[model samples]
Target chain A: MKFNHACKLILKNLFLIFILTSGVHGNENVNDKVKKLTLELRCMTCQNQSIYDSDADFSIDIKKLVKQKFHEGKTESEIKKFLVERYGEYILFRPLINFKNLFLWLFPFTILAIVTVFLIFSARKK
Target chain B: MKRIIVISPLIILFIICLFTLFYIIGNKDPNKPPSALLNKNLPSFTSKSLFDNEIILTDNDLRNKKIIINFFASWCTPCKVEHPLFFELAEQYPDLYILGFNHKDAAKDAKNYLKDEGNPYTFVGVDKDGLIALDFGVFGLPETFLINEKGKIVYKYMGPLTDKIIKDEIQPRL
Candidate 1:
């Protein structure tokens, strides 16, 4: 009976150690994920600074919230969508490629295509 | 093909000029970025009252009433500029529910500021760490939101309310 009690206590300690070490490693990855996600977020209080770059209270709170959301198993796009929904598209420095922004994204390429077509015709004429 | 090429540049220039004129004539103010929460349901929150810690106010309590949510801080000078307007608003619209959020200010300081200025709010909720403001997407202090009876955030104004704004923009909504 005495030996069985000691073995049970030993198993509990081993389980606790496993959880503690795993939690520490999980936290390291969580920080890295938080950094990457926050770099994409604008600090609403400071207005042009990235959340990762600003030391403002608003930025700090956002960083914590992002970290918490990541821990809650939210994906990067999910987090971005959530922030965009709350703060609007102005918060995203890199605009999404939606139908509204499709024109914005394709404009330069369209200009280049037009220029290329014009140049090819002019060269053929010469 | 040669004529098409010659006309394409003119077409491009015309489109550019058209968009530029549209932007200019649209009267878009660069200073004010439009609020995302417009026409959206109010974000839920349960906050302790500034005057009484035991007293709590939640999003549900605001339903079926026209609410004016004003985020203010004692440290914000612009909030001070719009301070007296709340009093006038309360008087004119007795049925309107004015929910004041004491945002990020020390509790004592918020109390003192309200005491000095006179509390025009129906209920003052303390947003001590600014989490509530974050949920509301409050970019800065002195941001005001008008909620309709259904608890949808119908309009949001991000600056001090002038008498002109109150008369023209706000009174009509009320």
Candidate 2:
């Protein structure tokens, strides 16, 4: 029983070690970076889904381009800026906080502030 | 004071209603996504000509002339609808260059479609992998971009071209 248990434990460790070492090398780092960038990019075809979550042809092309750009030594920001320059700010899953979209970004916070002020005044009245 | 407070919300609602009405009345085609390439220089790309694979077309080829870049695919139904309009425009304005960027389509099918529909394009480039369409930020097929002689994109139309669009929007610019 002890020999059988020891053999099973050895096999499990060997399997894990094999899996870990196999993926630790090569372009895995770049792939992770590409995945992170793709997650933030809105899939233009789907409109509502991120490229990472979409299987649309455009999303697939964008992912390939992202990985290729990374391989070409472009930084994440450069890739994002390139995409934004072509696709506009709409391609970002999060709307860019710019002068044009300032109201869009601030509206929720502004509403919260107004509600808080109203609550405080109502509490005082009570 | 209580009456004033009660009336304030009603006034606000009235203003909101007025604003909504104004927006609905003022804007046409509210569903059209704003083109990012408007007023921007054409995105540069190189691709093989759809008609002749040996011929390459670059951004420079599209410059020095007022051109209409139409994104189309043989599979897109709207493109077929707009096909005759392009032919009409091509004949009406011989100086105006109509370049077709075949998006995400097989080369053979694109050739066949053009053959059947009557090719109006001065040059057709195959965007087989859709990288060129991506450069143009094209979300849908049958999107048209009008580039001025200087190679800057002046206008974009998102859907099938109608006679009204040609007369009202494109004719004035041309």
The top-ranked prediction according to lDDT is 1
* Over 4 Å off, model 2: A1-26, B2-31
The sequence of per-residue lDDT tens digits that candidate 1 reaches over residues A84-107 is 887888788798989988877887
Clashes of each: 0, 0
Q: Please give the DockQ score of every candidate, comma-separated.
A: 0.46, 0.37
- Tens digit of lDDT per residue, candidate 2, span A1-126? 999999999999999998887767547898899889999998877857899999987788899999999989999989988989888777887877789888667756765665576567668767
**Relative to the true structure, how large is the alpha-carbon lDDT of every model?**
0.89, 0.86
| Highest DockQ against the true fold, candidate | 1
- Candidate 1 stretches with Cα past 4 Å from truth are A1-21, B1-5, B17-31
Q: How far out, in Å, is residue A14 in model 2?
A: 16
Minimum summed lDDT over a 10-residue window in model 1 chain A is located at: A113-122
Task: Give lDDT tens digits, candidate 1, residues B56-134.
Answer: 9999888899999999999999999999999999999999999999998999999999999999999999998888998
